[model samples]
Target: MPKITYTQPDGVQSVVDVNEGDSVMRGAVLNGVPGIVAQCGGGASCGTCHVYVDKDNTKPLPEMHPVEDELLHCTSSPRQDNSRLSCQLPVSAELDGLVVHVPETQI
Candidate 1:
């Protein structure tokens, strides 16, 4: 399992153990982390699972896909250089301790 940390706008953090092949959004959703909406259930179309990959922790993540590239622009939060959709990020050993920041709103 990979351990990930999700930080909310208020600085609160939720650390979760994610199964190897599960999406990061699934971990947050299953653990009841408040900021990740995941409305489309990991579908790339929703953009509701938007998160900011901590700039210092992003290098180990896989490259962003083309669909994720497009949907990121649809998030309610202003997109930053590190913006990413949690649903598009898969858990892996290389990404252990990955930290993502949740936006204030997903809608």
Candidate 2:
């Protein structure tokens, strides 16, 4: 399992352990973390699970797929170089301590 830190828009944070092979959005949903909506249930079709991965750690995450890239452009929050859809991030031991910042809103 890998522990991920989720920082909500209001500045509250939750550090949760995610099972390997599970999506980061799924981990947040299962743990009741107050940021990710995961409207499409881990599917890349929805942009509701948008997150801003800490810039320093972004390089370690897998590259964004074309579908995910396309969906990110639709996020309620502005997308940045560090922006990512949590649903597209799979957990792994190498990602332990990854940090993600949730936007103020997800439309």
Candidate 3:
């Protein structure tokens, strides 16, 4: 299983073990990470799962896809260079130590 840490704006952190092939968003949602509300499931149709990939592992993560780009623009929060839709990240051996930061809110 790949391990991921989701840190909220208030500094609350939730670390979850995710099965290979599962989206990081799904892992957050399933584990009850408060800052993530995956309203569009893993479709990338909504940006409720927006998060910032940790800079250390950001280069190792997959590049954003077109659909993810579109949805990322929907986030109510301002986007940053490292902004990403968690649904676009797949759980895998290469992402064993991925860290993501959940903004204060995503509506």
Candidate 4:
């Protein structure tokens, strides 16, 4: 399992131990974390699972595909340099201690 930290815009945090192959959205949704909406489940078709990867975290994430890039533009929150769809981020040993910030809104 990988321990991932999800931080809310209000500074609240939820630390969850996600199964190795599950997506970040899966971890948050299963644990009742308040910030991730995950409207499309893990399909990557919706931008509701938007999150900001911690700039200080050095772990490299997977390259974003064209679809995800396009969908990011549709997020209710402003897209950022570290913006990523939680559904696109899989859990792994290398991702332990990963911290992601939830934007103020997801629609």
Candidate 5:
């Protein structure tokens, strides 16, 4: 299990042991963390799972796919250099202790 943390807009943090192969969005949604609706499940069809990847230890994440990029641009949250769709992030040994910041809101 990898330890992943979700920083809320109010600065509260929810940390959980994300099972390997599980999407970050699924871990958050299943754990009842706020700010990630994951409306399209893990299909990358919706930007509701948008998050801002903290620069620290972010290099391990996969590059943004064209679809994810397009969807991020259309999200209500302001697009950021670190913007990522949580559903696009899969838990892995390389992602141990990963930290993700939940946006103010997800559309």
Candidate 6:
């Protein structure tokens, strides 16, 4: 399991131990974390699971697919340099301490 930290816009944080190979959105949804909606059930079709990868994370994440890149433009919040769909980020040992900031809205 890898420990991932999800921070809400209000600065609240939820630390969860996600099973290896599970998507970040799945981990948050299962743990009742209040930020990620995952409206598309990790299908990469919706931007509700959007998050901002912490600038402090040093490990490299997987490359974003073309569909995810296109969908990011539709997020309710403004897209950022670190913007990513949580459903596209899988849990891994290398990303054990990964931290992501959840936006205020996920419509």
The TM-scores of all predictions, comma-separated, are: 0.95, 0.95, 0.92, 0.98, 0.95, 0.98
1-107 per-residue lDDT for model 2 (tens digits): 79999999788899999999998899999999986889889879989999999877743788899999999899989999888999989999988999999998888
Model 6 C-alpha lDDT per residue in residues 10-85, reported as the tens digit of each score: 9999999999999889999999999799988999998999999998889769999999999999999999999999
Indicate the worst ten consecutive residues by lDDT in candidate 1.
Answer: 55-64
Question: lDDT rank, highest first?
Answer: 4, 6, 1, 2, 5, 3
Q: Report lDDT (CA) for all predictions.
A: 0.91, 0.90, 0.85, 0.94, 0.89, 0.94
| Each prediction's number of clashing residue pairs | 0, 0, 0, 0, 0, 0
CA RMSD of all predictions: 1.0, 1.1, 1.3, 0.6, 1.0, 0.6
Superposing every Cα of model 2 onto the true structure, what RMSD results?
1.1
Cα error, residue 5 of model 1, in Å, equals 0.3
Which residue pairs come into collision in candidate 6? Answer: none
**Per-residue lDDT of 21-66 in model 1, one digit per residue for the tens?**
9989999999999988888899899999999999887447778999
Regions of model 4 farther than 4 Å from truth: none
Model 2 clash pairs are none
After superposition of all CA atoms, the RMSD between model 4 and the true structure is 0.6
lDDT of residue 18 for candidate 3: 91
| Model 5 C-alpha lDDT per residue in residues 18-77, reported as the tens digit of each score | 889999999998899999988888899989999988877644888889999899889988
Q: What tens-digit string does per-residue lDDT give for candidate 3 at 1-107?
A: 78899988888788899989998999998888887888878788889999998767643778778888877777888888889998888888888878899987899
lDDT of 3 at 92: 86
Off by over 4 Å in 2: none
TM-score, prediction 5: 0.95
- Model 3: residue 41 alpha-carbon error in angstroms: 0.9
